[model samples]
Target: WQAKKLCPELVLVPPRHDRYAEISRQVNALYMQYTDLVEPASIDESYLDVTGSLPHFGLSAHALGDQVRRRVREEIGITISVGISFCKAFAKMGSDLKKPDATTEITRENYRDILWPLPVGALLYAGKRTCEQLRMQGIHTVGDLARTDRQALAALLGRGGDALWLAANGLEDAPVVPPDEQPAVKSVGNGRTFPRDLVTYDEVRRALITLSDEVATRLREAHMMCRAVQVSIKDPKLKVIVRQMQVGRPTWQRREISDTALKVMAANWREGAPIRALTVTAENLIPADQATEQISLFDAVPQKQREKQEKLERAVLQLRKKYGADSILLGPGDEEH
Candidate 1:
């Protein structure tokens, strides 16, 4: 309502996440009919690596793209634009050149003429803010960005600018990830915005316990362990403060994650400060099977005890999986209010 007062033309539509996901799956299935190497970029976009299928289909890239567009229009009753190129970046760039039902091809011989004249902001990852910065530096076009020195761009916009310059020049060769493959897990995190502001240590501790339990569960599910824990505290005024600390041992245990998150929170946040939200993130992830703990000489818990605790946790996890998530509770205050 407040936004409409400022912008009278604003139109709002309720999000249909489930329906969009189903549509995406159906579209990806159509891509798989042509090639198994389909990478879904988002709900509305995807990249297809049809190098091997090209010979079998007896069609050029542009023809294959046309076939895909026709198939989608006829079967799905939705029109799709496509771009055909040797690389994912340029292919994506080509796709954006046209609208609802068009196919644009960017071959090695013609890409320079087709891509270089576009504004620098048209490049992937170069948003409005980045374009403004680049324009201030006299980089107004994609050609200008490509010709700029990589080191100079890095100095101006950090590594992202240098990477963008490389991309503009068609120097990037990142492979399109296949649909069935899982990319390496970087971090697992969970956060919540409280209904009421919390200003007590007990409230904060309870919140951290709940968050850590979720994070630890996700880590275990991914077969990964975290070597560091980070806590983000957002005050009632929307100011945010983050603190992180490396753990003594890499762990996926709920107790360890909770304790570490609490330690960082205590170190960085005022004891009774009003907090609107908090997030606990497990970082520096490694495969659980490959994780080796450095046993301290003065360690309190023995290896046998630690092993037993992990076994018990795994058992509880299985019970929850078989019965229901609410079938088991860790402690007295574990139930969500």
Candidate 2:
């Protein structure tokens, strides 16, 4: 994130889910070699039950946690933070405190010394509003909550207050369970800003054409199609005007995405709007096989244009495969601003 922030001219691309899943398969396979009680919590985090594996690993739990951190960084080009505890709640809390290639440990004996000193909002399920409420009643910190009257808190906050009291004491009732099913991808989109604010319709139209084309090309490459197209116009004033559409099916056709975007641009935008950024988003995706067809019998788009797009998609994929990503982008991909 900092790398992208420092180089503001560089396009900040979304993390590719396909590439992540491929890496996850390898990491989980390695985890199973250590313990079968591991559960993936999110794309970047997991929970492991290593109670029975201490003998095999020939190390204490803290040592094992260190090994796991090393394994993640060595196997994947990413860093991970971990927390180990006797129970799920505190273990998660420990991990939350540890970040960016680090690990932490907590147990019942030292729970108050560690957890109590932290802010109340640092508890796993606590929210900002709850902390503010607690502070309003002179409970400014986790230590303050531990010293507060539970009966009065429960009376004031009702069930919510009771839950907070228990959590603050690390005495929750629920257990850590595993996720049940596969996770699916959500939205896919691309955005670019002009070298300067583009004022003419022709300039805006050209920029929209390039962005829409890039998005449509990638959607088809994923073997996915979109059900909706959204256009965003970001201006010098930092105000944004967005126009949305719900199309019936996914389309690889540039005309389909482009035409919809033109309507959005014309309807939602002002005639002389000074623009700082433009983004094109395609959402509610489906498999290519299930995507709805939009081309009509009467609308005969040019044959050469279709050939060019297909060739461009293939070329980009092939380059990304053989060389590396960003080795080549569509030449003159940007519109004159």
Candidate 3:
């Protein structure tokens, strides 16, 4: 409503899901021609590992990126931005630096010169809150973050901060997994941008509950249990921060997931901060059949109670699948925020 009010003549077009999926397939096919190590990041973005193919095609990494961009434009009538770098994270970062039929290359020798001066937020996965925390410590630029002690970063933002430090120093080594290989699922999560900013604890709690419920549902559907819960918060200004914590046990219960997400949010988020979006993710996943929960005599929640909740969640899932997603709603007292 705000956008339409600001621009009365603005046009709104509904998404064409089928058309987009078709185009995505064609683009992936084009990438396969260059290398089989094609990792589709999303319907519109992909990462191609052309190391082996570079020698085969007699082209440098940058040349291959340009060729792919040109082929995409000429064949599909769409322009793409390409980033060429030694590692997956840096390549992903480089791709975002340019747009619309451009290629940005970050070689090992030149990466520090090109990326070190940029803001810490420019690094992949460095959310808005993380940037603010880094700035608070007088670490302003990518170089500053890279130069900071890795142990300090880990203490500051957990493992994610450690990842940022690695990426800043160009030490990231994550590979672009091929589609046919079918890598194991590492995490299941959900997030949304609300229509309005959420200011109160109740509002944030409600949003977190919804997202956690969704994540739990997905985990259960896949026969998985997560030992950790991750939350990503995006403020009204479009800055984001991601944090996660161990749930103390591998579980697929919505109540547990929501509680852990709430804890994470409480630790990182300031009271009354206007949140534009919230995400809840289940991480450190293991197969439900394989997950062994150690029964603690000191456990606050009884094992029987936990089992009952799990049964209820499974029943709810069955109802949603048999009827419709909206056919049933969770009772108010199932869990507390």
Candidate 4:
């Protein structure tokens, strides 16, 4: 409504994430041709370490930036802003300082002149809240933060303060990460906002089972298993509560994930409280082949039964894959009696 008032004629387009992902891949492929140390920051942003490529290309940093910018504009029809600096933090700051189709360079000789006078909020990782906190202490610019005592900054914001101080002084040394060296998946989960509130245990249980099934499928697809299960429950009034518990043994099965989530919900929720949304998450993941569980001497039979059930589930999965996702499903009567 406010947008319409601001512009009598305005056009809005829906986002196409898949199309953006394809373009990102094409651009990343181009970056790889220039340097092996290309890091994708987002769908439309990336950081390339051209230190090694400079000697091979025989071009200075600013020249390399211009070359890449020209290629991207000509080949991909996208204009990118480039930032050249000694470190990742300053590079990010430089990138943001310029507009589309421009290059900004921050060097040891000129960084103080170019960056120190900028507002504290201009520094990377310093959000509005952090900027306000710094202003409260009479630190309003990058220079002020650089001059502040390290111990005082540490006392104010812990280790984050140390990082900010390093960035302000152009001492940040973090390296750009490549795609293959990216961190492992830390968790897998699925969530849903129901069309209407669920007010009974059976309703919430059904939703949890559905979400758990999705999470378990993702875990299996990734060849991983979760050692913990977490659930987020939101009331009709929009109040939310999160609860988590260890699963005792690693699992990538919907039965276990759903059961764990149910236990969490039961311990925290009222019997007939209306639920607005639900999320089921599998956490502390590990390779499924590397997961192990200690067996109880007295419960050997149950362990064997579980192994047989797992085999049956795998068979069901194969059958579904051969036919369709909805080809086969477990029913209430399918439970082991």
Which parts of model 4 have CA positions greater than 4 angstroms off?
Answer: 1-12, 183-223, 230-243, 247-282, 289-337
Question: Model 2 over residues 1-337: C-alpha lDDT tens digits?
Answer: 5666789788877556557766777777777778877778766667778888899989999998899889879877677778888877678889988688788888888989998888878876567767777878988777788778899989978888887788777776554444443345466688997768988887788788778767876786677788888998889876888888876445665556877887888888876778999999888888888754556655456545656766766666676656544455433433111
Error of 1 at 114 (Å): 2.7
The best candidate in terms of lDDT? 1
Best by TM-score: 4
lDDT of 2 at 35: 82
**lDDT of each structure?**
0.87, 0.75, 0.86, 0.87
Ranking by TM-score: 4, 1, 3, 2
Per-residue alpha-carbon lDDT of candidate 4 for residues 104-179, written as tens digits (9 for 90 to 100): 9999999999999999998888987688889999999999999999989989988999999999998888889997
C-alpha lDDT (0 to 100) for residue 15 of candidate 4: 60
**lDDT ranking from best candidate downward:** 1, 4, 3, 2
RMSD of each: 6.6, 7.5, 7.4, 7.1
- In model 1, state the lDDT of residue 63: 92
Measured against the true structure, the TM-scores of the candidates, in listed sequence, are 0.65, 0.56, 0.64, 0.67
Model 2 TM-score? 0.56
Weakest ten-residue segment in model 4 by summed lDDT: 328-337
Model 1: per-residue lDDT, tens digit, 1-337? 6678899999988565546667788899999999888889988999998999999999998899999999999998889999988888899999999997999998889988999999998899998768989999999999999999999999999989888978888888988888469579899999999878999888899999989988988899899999999999998888898889998788998878998998998888777789999999999999999998677777647766778878877887787666556566556464322
Off-target runs (Cα >4 Å) in candidate 2 are: 1-29, 35-61, 72-80, 85-93, 96-101, 106-180, 189-222, 232-242, 247-249, 252-263, 271-280, 292-296, 302-304, 330-337
Model 3 agreement with the true structure over 1-337: per-residue lDDT tens digits: 7889999999998566547767999999999998899999889989888888889999878887888888999999999999888998788879888876789998889989998998888987887878989999999999999999999999999999999989899898888888667678899989898989999888888788888888888888788999999999989888889999998789999999998998998899888889998889999999999998678877747787888887888788887677555566554554522
> Any idea what lDDT model 2 has?
0.75
